[model samples]
Target: MAIAQSLTTTASLHYTPFIRELFDTLLTDSWCEVSSNRAIEFVEGEADVAVEKLVPYETRSEQGIFFTADDITMKIVNSLAAEVAVEKSFFDPSCGAGNLLLGIAKSYPIKKNLNRTIEYWSKKFGGCDLHDNFVIAAKLRLIALAAIRHGLPSISEGQLASFVRKFDKFYTGDYLEADVGGDFDCVVANPPFGHVVASRSNEWSSGRTQLAAIFVDKIISSGKKGQKLVAVLPDVLRSGSRYERWREKLAKETSCGAVELHGRFSKSVDVDVFILNLNNKPSVVGQIIEWVPPVTDTEGSVRLGDLFLVRVGPVVPHRLEEGDEDFPFLCAKNAPAFGVTFPEERIKFGGTKFLPPFVVVRRTSNPCDKNRLITTLVKGIEPVAVENHLVVMKPFKGGVNSCLKLIKALKDPKVTSRLNNVIRCRHLTTKSISSMVLQGV
Candidate 1:
């Protein structure tokens, strides 16, 4: 008997009336593990319904629907397959419960018309997840889905285990350290969100780095010539900050395209996601495409690049003290302090020294709406010294004209709201200070 069948059969004998009812309710509906305090009450009601009906508990304990939002899954699969030819093999580095894998499998044939043969399509699909439970659950889900379509019983556990072993695939391990060897035709994944602090105790410590950025680096390193990749990333990278240098290098090393996804996909984690495609060829300069679903906006369309300018903030060396009048400074501490006064002291400008303008944006806010970029419209005014935590960006070409435009654009309620969640301020530079500025222009 199959493992699922055996587990179900054994469950029938041991399950109580209430437990049996709960099992039946789960089997019939979209229920997964309910841990929320409020959700627990609903589970109890469903359990009562099962008990009143005296239903036998025949559902398999391990079998439950992996909850990946269907809409996001569909978009990701469609977008990826649309970008690349179907004949190319696809891999998901962190394929959570194989939702993306299954979506790709379904869409590949219809979109590309390359998977007419069952064996051919199966060979093209590959995925890996660190969670053993998720891996097993995904294997079962895939086998079940395949069985329904192909008219066969679910694959036996032993057979499934063998399949994983034969491919040298599906071993449980951290994706960061996993050796995914060589380049794949296409790579897709929604890696874990948030920063992973590097400490002496951690095995994967490589200084302090955000987990999301590291995933991008890993994908680039794992990719081979002509390999294509799609990943969901936070909007933090768009700012031309120090992080941009890494992204710029990645872009140069592997030509890449980005598409941003707005709104919340997971109720548990609130983050804006962007889908990035990386290929071995040189990227077309100035090519940026932003896709925000119709639900996110009634305005019809929005481009990710148009909404904001992403750049690194100013960096103040330790030599500059807080009260020193030598330079104007905006440090992280000044943010939210209330009644903090700007120090007004001027120092002599020497060779290669220039005062750059900047705005202090608070880093923590929902949708990043609290952050504002400050630029002075007055010409020939040098920016005060910026302390750490304040980003300084001046017009690259247009002087006061550009600064005015940025300030006007950010003043919008919608844009300001988003800025507040991520940035404390955006600092603008004067025409005289920018590297690109011609002496008298």
Candidate 2:
């Protein structure tokens, strides 16, 4: 609510009366001239009163509602719009306040004639959301948009007011429970991401189901034949073990592609996310992903891939690998500076004696903290394996003699800082970690 009010206050100072009147008209159907001359003191006081009326919800629900910035929504819609013609109809089953719909509505050329713009806005989009308030908000925004299409400069109070209660742009109901009819050419959204809660208020709230999964299921099963869809979802959906079935379903069922987004929407959201485009007619043969490598230059740094016999953790239960035996399992927490910290709680999973000497580096760290290039030297006893979260760096067939000096070189502050600066997103990957430069360590 404070966010909404802050924006209003800014508009009051910089905007003309006509524009503020238009916005004030949206929030409270009262049409009046906006006054900026009432002094900053008056504006601040009024903004506080307006904020008090808002019914705010905590943003921490497992099923999140991180609204996408308008620019972000425009990009996703434009990407899908590029695939299919924009003149055709589109839908957002989870459209909240109609941002995506409004985004699409505004995508067409700004109208020199309000009638033409209204025609395009009316025909260019349609949507369905679960809440009445969102449906109403979506309509109000479109009306304001209709006023803009008429050219914001020429809008009269009566002319814009006439647009009110006129749009059948969206419906209010659970999108997953029913098909809110429309053979839309495309469906785009930033769907909810996370495990369901137990309020019995939402369909999957009581189960372990992820709401995002349910949204996808609905889009695929209910969409018209050949309908294309673009959505923003938690990155885990692209590769989590539990979601393997979901991937197989797509491989055998629809033509789908996913692109991971780089920087986060805001600092409050830490989870990495990806955009997915799916179609019934096999728009894509298989999955296509874009993974940008993290790279940097340091005085004495070298690519881990160049010297290490990199292997991911064996795909077996670490606990099940426990054969009532003590095996030196290299977990990330066990790395202690230049030496290895073999705590009593080590995972017991020594598969064979053929394992060779190797050094393990922590895979990820807090982005704000030191680029934790914490390396552990494993050489005194038989070589052990590491958890998947750790990158195993071993000598290439005949490249380097020992990982001892390599570990020491990696600990250099400049080396670690350079390596950290190369992060594509917020963490280090074995692929990225292995590609750093190194002095002849």
Candidate 3:
């Protein structure tokens, strides 16, 4: 006799009479997980009923479907409950598949300590999402998780669904538009938010609206005086000219700091992200902001500002579509350490004399790269024009050998390590790069 897989796996879903009907009715064409290790492949067809037909009148909102990694979820949960046991109400306003709820249970040992009853969980943890399908999925996942914790081999579909619907209280609605209506002690969320997905809002100035910014505004605005809001946010809020106002607001209102994470969290995404912590704690002694404040160690350190007249390249638009001239242009790609691939992204250099023997450094990179500052020495006297992607470092008084030496030195591991703190949000601005302190110039 072959052993069957347990129901604990994310993909290995236990078959239930109600579950099958729920999928057939609501999902209509979604596939169930056959095994734990295998991916839950979705085979879809024409929906028997329209999505709006299944969607109730009360629940209608935009779906930001990005989810958090398991390890990340645990870390957020652990960090939130570090000083105090999170026995109070735990919530994720934009809860997806009950991942945060699971994390909360694991961290506090809710199922282990308090009896796994609908009444207990109902009071302990609650959340809301925009999508009804996600709400259903989240509820089911929570039920399955609870079943495992309670050591129940099999749970009736009707009973499990009833408990989840009654206690979980995860209805489909816009978290920002309407209130989830909870006096939460701990709030942890990793919503689908970024600058690309940002939309204009009447509250802020023209073009000042972003999904993350709006969410942060709402989160901080509605935040109670003595609650903690932990989130995984895009690095845009950390720096950038547009978010300066929000940054000031965040600094004044709550004890906020950003801890940058390493590597890509998922397959499709490879942008730099940070753990944003805002503790609205009553106490002031333990509150402090952690960031790379502008303070260079002046003791034997040579600032890059002294050596070069650093100026960001000018905007040269329509390079490919409407270019009328050909000249050597140095972009970020051409500025590899110790060398230059000049004349590659050829653009109209115009009648301007760019000259040569200038250092070009990459203006942007992910912090995970550790050493994002790639430099190249432009030696040739070709009429060279640089793009905005590179910062042209003109020598105050130097020659070819000096530029080469600077390039070699910058590429050194020690030098890059020193510059690590100076590089913010994977961008080496003219001000930041210039402020970089070198051991020996």
Q: Which candidate wins on TM-score?
A: 3
Q: Write the per-residue lDDT of candidate 2 for residues 1-441, one digit (tens) a residue.
A: 232343344332122232343345444332234422222222123322222233233533443655555556767767766644537677788775566766666555545676566655665567776555455455556666655444343444454444433456667777867766337778887777667533455332345766787688678777777777788776555534455566566655566555545344545567656667667646445653322234545676556577666655551453545545565555666667567554334455645421445677766655445546777766545446466676767776642256776777787776665554444244456555666677766
Error of 3 at 371 (Å): 4.3
Q: How well is each residue in 46-122 modelled by candidate 1, as lDDT tens digits?
A: 32233224433332112211234456667777777654453667777776556666667654543122113334545
Model 1 TM-score relative to the real fold: 0.54
* Worst 10 contiguous positions by lDDT, candidate 2: 35-44
Query: All candidates' TM-scores?
Result: 0.54, 0.63, 0.73
State candidate 3's TM-score: 0.73
The alpha-carbon RMSD values of the candidates against the true structure, listed in the order shown, are 11.4, 8.6, 8.4
lDDT of 3 by residue, 1-441 (tens): 000111122221122222344333322223233321111211111111223344432332233345676667767876767633737677787776566766676545434421355556677676777655555555554544454455433444454445655664565688788666346777777766543333454344346355766776777667677677877776555655466666666666676555544334445355445677776634553434554445557677777789888877764555433346777777765566656554556666554435687888877766666567777778675767777777888777776766765676676676565455544466667876787676555
lDDT agreement with native, every candidate: 0.46, 0.57, 0.58
Candidate 2 lDDT for residue 291: 28
Reference-based lDDT, residue 257, model 2: 51
Q: Is candidate 1 or candidate 3 better by TM-score?
A: 3
Q: Candidate 3 regions off by >4 Å?
A: 1-64, 83-86, 111-116, 196-209, 256-260, 281-288, 293-299, 319-329, 332-337, 340-356, 364-371, 380-384, 399-402, 415-428
RMSD of 3: 8.4
